[model samples]
Target: MLAAATALFALVASASAQALPSSAASPEQLALVDAQYNASGFPDSGAILTVSYASFVVQNGNAYTAEQVATAPTIYVTPSTTTRDEFNSSSVYTVMLADASSLGDPDTEGNYRRVLQRSTHYLVNGQTGTSTGSNYTFEPSGGT
Candidate 1:
């Protein structure tokens, strides 16, 4: 039992060190997501945008998997974004994502009902990228 616990701990630690990115939503993408959030008055701001993960292509310098990427609640902060129309309409932008049981319980308690939120940092028109800090927050569904 003790050995199993140790192994589990090691696995989690390693995963954190290897957090991954699903997709790169350039600055252009973020602008769209932001517009949608602002227009919606931040109404479940996340739902207005779409988020997903595929095999990590390459960013600064790292390889990642979908499961590893899903551990984080802040998908947008990592490098994801929304469409052009969505960015133009939203005032505040955030990325919506599905959380897995291993990471933690979702706030909705429903598997698909869960989501991750991220706010915008800076923006530029005609540019296809945005810079994001490591700022993010996760809201779980239940106390369990």
Candidate 2:
């Protein structure tokens, strides 16, 4: 009886550990993230911005591409004004977004886990009252 009880407790503990992150954020937070993603519309300035994604690589007995990697909630960050021409000509600045998690994980092969959460981030260059347009577009690789 003692052994059976101990085993049951261990199983329950394991299950709880896995379930913790699922409920980390409240429904309100999730809604806010969704709104931000949808509200990131561009202006009519005809400016374009290219984006690149980079992050740590976790090796769990195998390699994975960026797409294969699990990224956390993503956030889009844009410039305050149209920077497409500036970004292209100067190559100094670019737009960015992130998907982050409070409880980051690691793979079983002693590697940090990739973003697994669905939270996403996005940015707009100006506020509703601001007239400074910063509409942008991305110049994907290989003209694709």
Candidate 3:
């Protein structure tokens, strides 16, 4: 009975190991992903952006799968027009997943979600005037 139990344990271990993904991204692949992300121009603002999280997904193709999370910087802008006091505010956070080639360029199959908020304030002659209310949009790619 002990021998049989040992054999069963070994079988379970082997099966578990086999069930894991063999094509997981390596450190080099992750570096490539970072480079691609930096060059993608997703953050076109002056605010500093940084990656908060990253991971890999296993798929049935030659492409490498990666997911990244990033944050946008708070922006404040004032218009020059003296007739009205105008200020703009905006912020965004994003999550993206992509299937990339060996060179780290995103392929056709990818998805991204961005949580964006923006507002414009206007004061005519320093008095309370018509102001654009804050707007929020949760944009996401159309895919499962």
Candidate 4:
């Protein structure tokens, strides 16, 4: 057990703190992700992700401020304004909402995990996506 723990520690110590995306993103996108990840404290995620999917943070009719989203009950992703026709209608997608500051906003387990200005982050899973013509509608795997 001691040897196994040592091996694990070595593996983690050698890994890059910067997230290396597994998905195919353009150079620009990859750069942006790296910058954001670095800026956000290079989270110690349970499982390192290879690709960060594009997700919209819309509250009103369009993009919203964190303050706006902090109070909103529902937030969903709409089709990308520039590329609406490139989506595959039959593809099922796994959408992850990570980096949501869960520190100092509201009470999450009495810890108050509502990030006001990029505090600690959290990874929200179980939300799956289904293509709806030119857009995708995401819902919890079991139901809405």
Candidate 5:
């Protein structure tokens, strides 16, 4: 009985850990990103948008050729406008550039993970206003 209880506890703990939420972009966030990208005049004619717990991406967009998706620089967005505290917190969304070459053995899923890792752009809500840079720019719609 003692051993069974211990095993059950361990299983529960592992399951709980696996079930913990990751800060990935939401549908609303994705739409905001798309709008901002369009507003910036950065064409994404062939890009594909995908979402996962790890990241959100505009894969194979006009930003990069199909073959170059592995090494292209990408924009990343936080699920919501980040506060100074949230930006400093560990639970902040993962937005960075991830290369397809660095993905995994199978490469497909790994490529997605890598893309999530390499997101360099962030999406700010209307409340936060707009921001711009040499490599990245975000202008929220509706004059916000």
Candidate 6:
């Protein structure tokens, strides 16, 4: 029950940070994330520019529930290179967040199909990069 918006805050927090140029995502990165989108009942936008993950940590609560995230929670943004040699630590990046209601349901014929509504939570531009490295902690307050 992970909150989809958690990634939005993480991007908002990471907008000022730098691109973490890790060993480019594996060859299966795009497929993996694409499959995720399909499974989540959302259409693929084909904009998997880079690899990113937002870790939301809430004290004494679960992210899946509304009561647990009454307010913004702590977010950690980690972005890495998507390809082998196309990432520039100084270039700008964009982040988008969308909400998916369910993991898809079966169709009338008993075949699984995506059948959930998708609403965009946020789309951020002017996302700059920070230092270059594999490990960098970016928080809304600032770098740590």
Q: For residues 1-144, could you state the per-residue lDDT of candidate 1 as single tens digits?
A: 000000011001111113433344345544554553343223222221222235322221233344545432222223234322332212333222222223332336553233223211212222122333332211111111
What global local distance difference test value does model 1 have? 0.27
The most accurate candidate by lDDT is 6
Using Cα atoms with residue i matched to residue i, what is each candidate's TM-score against the true structure? 0.20, 0.19, 0.17, 0.26, 0.20, 0.38
Query: For model 2, what is the C-alpha lDDT against the true structure?
Result: 0.24
- Writing each residue's lDDT as its tens digit, candidate 6 over 26-118 gives 335445545644654454322223223343332211135444444433333443333323233455555544442334544553332221234
Writing each residue's lDDT as its tens digit, candidate 2 over 34-88 gives 3433433312222211122244322112333445333421112222233323333
Query: Model 3, stretches more than 4 Å misplaced?
Result: 1-43, 50-104, 110-144
Clashing pairs in 6: 17-129, 17-130, 18-129, 18-130
Error of 5 at 31 (Å): 11
Which candidate model has the greater lDDT, 5 or 6? 6
Pairs with steric clashes in candidate 5: 47-61, 76-121, 96-117, 96-118, 96-119, 97-118, 97-119, 98-114, 98-118
Q: Give the alpha carbon lDDT tens digit for every residue of 1-144 in model 4.
A: 000000011001111213332332344543443443453334322221222113322211122345433431222223223322333333333332223332223455444233323332222333343442332322223222
Error of 2 at 96 (Å): 14
**Full ranking by TM-score:** 6, 4, 5, 1, 2, 3
Give the CA lDDT, 0 to 100, for residue 97 in model 4.
28
- Candidate 3's residue-wise lDDT over 1-144, tens digit each? 000000011001101111222232234433433444465433212211111112422222323212221222111111112211222222222222222222224534442121011111111111111222321111111121
Best model per TM-score: 6
List ranges where model 1 is wrong by over 4 Å.
1-24, 43-77, 80-144
Weakest ten-residue segment in model 3 by summed lDDT: 1-10
Candidate 4 all-Cα RMSD = 14.9
